[model samples]
Target: MQQTKRIAIIAHNNKKNDVLEWAKFNRFFLAQHELYATGTTGKLLEQEIGIPVHKLQSGPLGGDQQIGAKISMQEIDILIFFWDPLEPQPHDPDVKALLRIAVVWNIPIACNRASADFLITSPLMRVEYQPYLPDYQEYLNHNYDQQTTKVRQEQPVSLDTA
Candidate 1:
């Protein structure tokens, strides 16, 4: 409903604290926009930085999938994911998928604190960016609309045999 940019935060185990610290130092800049993040990361950000965040689930347990869906739906404008480069994760598939979606949606992505820092201070973020994005919903809605129409065409049948 709100037209303000939606920024999502997600961090790997090794970088969660780093992300929280970065958020704390940049709280004033981050407070002006809507924020979302994975469950633990969101909770930690709140407890440590005092910034509210809409929480999803843990990334290994479908949190990335949740945010990916939002990105596909054009609901997310920025993605700040602080991932661990030194460690490999079993859920890399989901993490990669989330990042891929961010690229496909043309949303700005920051994978580290430095990038996030630069992003939080950028002037463009405070401005509207809708006009720069291409028309996309028509293609995305094709399957949903077809399924809805098919469902509507089918009449409900009541069981009369007893």
Candidate 2:
């Protein structure tokens, strides 16, 4: 239900192609949203896919840091980082740390093509945040508390009640 004003995309060495393919597949959804990406990946997407992408430096060359900063500032909504699971990246720690922050922020993220598809295809992707959605987190937390309290109330009143 959110505007999803901005989204950041990143891809490891081996996954750039995969991300590009997915990007092309979602060009319609992407065109309506602002896009951010690392140097090479952004360039490729812009050149081949014709999508305007705000380019950061190469991930290993401080681009990841830039994206992390945006994430912390709540300037980013969705993040898609296609990681190379098999290869060892020198900047692996930075990637992990950035992902940790995304989790903490409760941002919607798509690490692979499948998840990305689901997210982009969701009916709410381009819709404005409904009144109920804006406070969904708080509502969920309160509901959880009520459910726990109800469980306690329904517990045996006494060991010898019968």
TM-score of each: 0.79, 0.77
TM-score of 2: 0.77
Which predicted model would earn the best TM-score?
1
lDDT of each: 0.86, 0.84
Could you report the Cα RMSD, in angstroms, for every candidate shown?
Answer: 5.9, 9.5
- Clash list (residue pairs), candidate 2: 1-129
The regions of model 1 sitting more than 4 angstroms off are 1-3, 135-162
Leading candidate by lDDT:
1
Task: State candidate 1's TM-score.
Answer: 0.79
